[model samples]
Target chain A: EDKVVQSPLSLVVHEGDTVTLNCSYEVTNFRSLLWYKQEKKAPTFLFMLTSSGIEKKSGRLSSILDKKELSSILNITATQTGDSAIYLCAVDPSSNTGNQFYFGTGTSLTVIP
Target chain B: EPEVTQTPSHQVTQMGQEVILRCVPISNHLYFYWYRQILGQKVEFLVSFYNNEISEKSEIFDDQFSVERPDGSNFTLKIRSTKLEDSAMYFCASSALPQGYRQPQHFGDGTRLSIL
Candidate 1:
């Protein structure tokens, strides 16, 4: 079975503080990794990492993948109260059948004012 | 921006009853998927549909669960028999292509199903 594990299940940080969330996975055929942000309802797409070393960035958020270690990290710099939300990591494994996406129990972030 | 839309922001049903959740994915997207998240739990994959057929499904998707494109724009998930365990937030997602490496899925605001 494909498995994904995220570290620091919960984090509490003050506004303007920087935080990093980690995700590691074990799969038979790894194709790509994706990150999502969930506030109260639906999750919104963040970044999809396919290659290692290169970073994908959007505003204050950036993520990088390490294929050699089978892990990825999401960094949020100068975080604001609006950035407080669950950060989810999912992996897509290569299969002859349809694409299967496995998600890690997300890291819940709480940003204090 | 185009978004996937789901009807009935919330639904309450009795056990053993049948329920159909509706969704209309982003126009022009070819692949569709259904996922669920129990409160305080990880989001689980239920099924994926493409080319008017089922491309993949998880063990959670048993005989009681069925999906259909039914019409040109709507995708539906029907649960023949509901259980208390079935209470969760069901999400509909769509992507422009089948290849994960090419297109990432966009999710809808999910319908919260409460089974009594």
Candidate 2:
């Protein structure tokens, strides 16, 4: 079965600390990988990585995809309490019929001040 | 910036009763999607709609569930018979592209459904 797995289901870090989140997937006809930050009720768009080795960055957050390893990583530098949230990883496979996103369990990060 | 909106922040219904979740996607978006997240569980894809028809659906989207674009701005998900396990946070999302390849999906705040 196609599955997306994320490591360190839960993490606790102090303010100013840096963290790395991992996501690995085994799905057919891979198209792209997306990262979202879910706070409270909504999952906000963070980054979309379609090419291998090229990193997508926004402010203090960045992500990279590795097609060969079938994995990706999200890095957050200078973390703040505002950054605390459940980070979600999703993979969308190339298909002619339609697009369905396979999501991971998500990594819950709590940044303490 | 325009965002997806869902009505009724919470809904409580009895088991076996029917429930309808409403959503208004971004005006220019071409693809619409529905997803549900059980407490402490990952978000699961339910269905995708485009061109006023269902483009694709997941295994979880069985006969009990149905989707429709009733008007130009409204998208609805109807659950024929609610079950205890049906209690979850249902999210509505939209994207400008069909595959959402480079364009990411924008999500709403979500409606929390409770089945008694």
Clashing pairs in 2: none
TM-score of candidate 1 against the unseen true structure:
0.98
Error of 1 at B107 (Å): 0.4
Write model 1 residue lDDT over A1-113, tens digit each, in one string. 78999999999999999999999999998889999999988889999999999999999999999999999999999989999999999998876367657999999999999
Residue range B1-116, candidate 2, lDDT tens digits? 99999988899999999999999999999899999999999999999999999999988999999999999999999999999999999999999985644788899999999999
Any idea how many clashes model 1 has?
0
Off by over 4 Å in 2: none
User: Residue B69's C-alpha lDDT in candidate 1?
Assistant: 97
Model 1 CAPRI rating? medium
Provide the DockQ value for model 1: 0.75
